[model samples]
Target: MLTIVNDFLWGQILIVALVGAGLLFTIGSGGVQFRYFGRMFSVLRRGFHHEQGHISSFQALVVSVAGRVGSGNIAGVAVAITLGGPGAVFWMWVIGLMGMATSFFECSLAQLFKRYQPDGTYRGGPAYYLTHGIGQRGLAIIYSVLLLVTFGLGFNAVQSYVVATSLQASFGVATWVTGLVMVLGLAVVIFGGIRRIAVVSELIVPLMALMYLCAALLVIGMNITAVPAVLGHIVQSAFGLEQAVGGGLGVVIMQGVKRGLFSNEAGLGSAPNVAAVAHVPHPVNQGIVQAFSVFIDTIIMCTCTAVIILLSDVYQPGASDVDGVVLTQTAMAGHLGSWGAGFVSVALVLFAFSSIMYNYYLGDNSLSFFSDENPLVANIFRVLVLALVFWGSLQDLSTVFGFAELTMGLLAVVNLFGLVWMYRIGVRLLRDYDGQLRSGKETPRLRTEDWTDLDIDERAWRD
Candidate 1:
């Protein structure tokens, strides 16, 4: 079943979907992630002000970051290294880099096109952006359903699995116990809604990420002298130019791309859902916040994971018994002993725990959109999500992760296609933002009725 789902998920269909969307976005956006990378911090400053949106720009970005930066950076990194060797890390880099433009463009579209409420709130994402941006409501419905299943149910469930697996591996906890505890915990947060999720993420994401990176980088820095050679090995192995054992060029490239996409979720259209809710004056403003998200998730966090693996020299042949987080722990243990393994156990729990809340809120908001704010439908989605928490925690997580990956890969291909159509819109928005900056404008407004008709997120303007 696992192989079959993976075959379908990573099949030629998804391969085309994943790569085609990113490639198209890369060309269409003029490589915006890198072009705008230096400006992200400044743009992010907009998040500091209170706004009229659902959440602060920083809060929304962090909420999405909480979701995107989870097990993928940790266990997912180990999986990529285990299967693809060091060369795979190179492919992951390509995805994170190229994927950011996709993320920025999508968030820009979502922001520019979202629907605002009379109560000074907003709602948008693939459904709103695809429908409004592409002028196709039908396709938007299709996209929403896919997202509902994928990110809402599928990814959240996978998060539970990572928690269960990590606990089982490191602490000998039963999967049932893991599932029940998580279900109860997730239920509490999901019931609290996006604001609560944002708050929790604001607290947990920074601390967990800081702790994880500090631990990983300590190991990487210790092996700093071996970094160059390890990078060489990764490059040579990626193309199978150096001849890896029991795998070919396909395995090498796919592992990195798969894990990397899972890491930052730039092109996957998931983060933009949260990005749509962030309170920013301009669409591109949120885009910059998202651009930094990709860099942080992959370049900083996942790179740390890759560095530790490389430095530990664990990509050696026939190393299949240890994979995922265990592989990462082994690498850490080699450098830091048992204490390092303890850190992995704690980090995975926190990372996966935070992701559960992120996914739950995303799913809830998505359902609210679909139901046109019908309370009944909203309640059902929440109930179903809580139910899945137990199902996911106890059951094998790879099942849900596999399905979610397929859904995300499909959405990226479909959504990126639509994003290409928004190029003219992006140019106009960017020009508008630049004009404001040039005018030495302390405060900028979205001059278009198009912006007002959609969601009005002006929290950045609040005191």
Candidate 2:
């Protein structure tokens, strides 16, 4: 029943809504993502701005990236190629481009509606805005619960399962052992607090991404002559009128859009959880940074994974028996020998580890909305998370993935409503931010009084 529902949601509803929302926001924002694309780096260069309850913009970037760029980039891309064929890669790119806009709007709205905790930390997300901005407590509660289930629990299980599978395949280790090790490591970080998670993400996200990209570069360099042909093949397969290249056009579009959404999560409403926690002068700045995250995840890391697999002899389109992580591992090993598999196992550990932590923070943030004063709620959740890690490590790949898709699709549909409902505020915030940037100031700050109509926390932006 769950699988059937997810198939319809992902295939018919979400595929359309996801792409449509992204394109809609892209137009409504005056293509701010592209217009201010160069400025994204400038904001990032300004770096961490320490505040009482907020994280630095760069720290937010890494934490969000930790969630965005994960086992999905590696395993998910392989799944797209296997089920959807090479054409899926093209669709993934399309979604990534449009998703930049969706991410910007959602993150901007999150920041705009953010509230402060008594402990001085920040809190906000689709739930916060749905209640505060639109005055819909029921909708807010629904979104919070959906977020908790989808990312906090379901997605964490998927990450653990992916890494556990990779380690098992590469080193002949027991999955239970991997699960035990993962639980211990995760318990230490998640129990340490959100800042500790941010600190770990800051250090690990960049290092792991660079190492994997470098390895991919080596593989691509070795097959330099075939690079142009592979690009042409991807384009041709995507639009091929016939069954010349694997899964035809329909499968291509479906797999590409689905996996791309899973990997980049631009329209999925997950990034805003971390984005809203950033200490930025303006919400639009963090929006841009989060938008940039879409590019990094899909355009860079995912593309690398696709190239490595497609360039190697290990990948065969329409191979139903192919293991997603194993396909990627085989591709790497094809070029780097035995050490390649080892490297993939290690990379998956790092990528999935940071992702698990970020995923926990997202869930932890959602939990706060329900029980701001209940420490026991958080403690119970921690135990549940650890238990899921072990249980997921031992579960079958098909079941874990199916459950993840169902939860994530539902989460996306709920959050997309919040984005479309709050569209005006997002645009207004963007315009105000642009106006400040164009005013020739070294630093631009948002003034809450300018928009007294919206229910913004005035103290958050007060200088």
Candidate 3:
């Protein structure tokens, strides 16, 4: 049943919605993702500066990136190749490109409709936007529940499963031991709230990414002669022009889209939950920053893993027994010897650990929509999340991934529906930001007074 639902969602409904909506948003926004490509860095650089006690835009970005650049980059990429072939990497690239625009709109809307919390913080996401932007309280509730289930429970389980399996494959560590360590570490950080998560992500995300990229670069350097052949094969396999490990073109596309969305989370609506937490002068600023994060995750981080695996001799085109984190681990070991496997295991721990933190925040934020920020309710939710993390370690890969994919598809559908319906408002925010830039302002600021017709939180945006 889970596989059937996932097949329908990934093979039919979601691929169209994700690609079509991304194209629409890209065209509708005048290719804002492209136009602001360089500007994203500038916005991110400025994002480092924030008012005291507020979440800086850069912090918010790393939190979203932490959520994105996890097991999906390493284990998920391996799964794509195992099932979809090298061609799936091409589709992953395609989705990453289109997803940038989709991320921008969703995140901008999140920032726009965000609520001002009494604790001098912000709270918002698709749930807040649905109710506050379109007067749909019931839909908001549904989105909140799905968010809680998808990120809070389903996706976090997937992360735990990946890390546990990777560690067991590499170091002979017991999966149960890994689960307990992860649960204990996660409990300490999550209880500290979003700020601590942000700080930890800020430190770990950059350093870990750099180390992983350097490792990939070393592999690419060693296999410099095969670089052209590997690149050509990925493109050829994507079109079924070459016989490869995965099935036909359909399987290639499906795997790519599924794993790609899983990796970067462009249109999945997960990033917006964190995007809404940033203290930015204009909503579009954070939107641009978030868009850049998708690029970092899929284009940079995921591609590194793909190159490492494909460039390795251990990766046979159609191997059956080797898959998931083990494939990645084996491929790395084949390159850098035994230590290579250890490196991947350590990297997975850091990546998935940060993701657990990011995922916890999303679930906690979603609970706020229903519980009115009740402390007891929040603690209970944390306990449930911790339980899932441990439970995930004992489960098989397929079961955990299938459940996560099903819930993620449902959540994306709801969020995409809201994005399509609220298209014009997204455009207006873009134009307003552009208008300010054209008027010679170095930083575009949101003037809440100008959007009187919209249900924006005035106190949240007040200078």
Best by lDDT: 3
lDDT of 2: 0.86
In what order do the candidates fall by TM-score, top score first?
Answer: 3, 2, 1
Error of 3 at 273 (Å): 0.5
83 in model 2: Cα distance from truth in Å? 2.0
lDDT of 1 by residue, 1-463 (tens): 7567667666566566666767766676667776767778776776866554368888877888888888888888888877776778889988888778777778877887767765566778877877777677787777777888887889877777778878888889998899898878777777766777887788899999999889977886788888888778878887788755567888888888878877887766788788877777777888878878888898889988888877875557547754678788888888898888878888888888888787777677678776777767887888898788788777766656666776776776666666767667776676677678789985455666544543444442232
- For residues 1-463, could you state the per-residue lDDT of candidate 3 as single tens digits? 9899888987889889999999999999999989999998888778898887788999999899888998889888999988888999999999998999999999999999999998889999999999998888998898889888888988888888888887887788999999999999888889988888898899999988898999999999999999899999999999999857536788888889888987898877889999998898899999999999999999999899999999987777777854678888889999999899899889989998998899899999999999988999999999999999999998986776778778888888988999999999999999999999999999989998899999999988987
lDDT of 3: 0.90
Tell how far residue 282 is off in model 3, in angstroms.
0.2
Using TM-score as the yardstick, the better of models 1 and 3 is 3
Each prediction's TM-score versus the true structure? 0.90, 0.96, 0.96
- Scored by Cα lDDT, where does model 1 land? 0.76
Candidate 1: which pairs clash? 50-459, 51-458, 51-459, 52-459, 86-234, 87-234, 114-455
Cα lDDT computed for each candidate against the true fold = 0.76, 0.86, 0.90
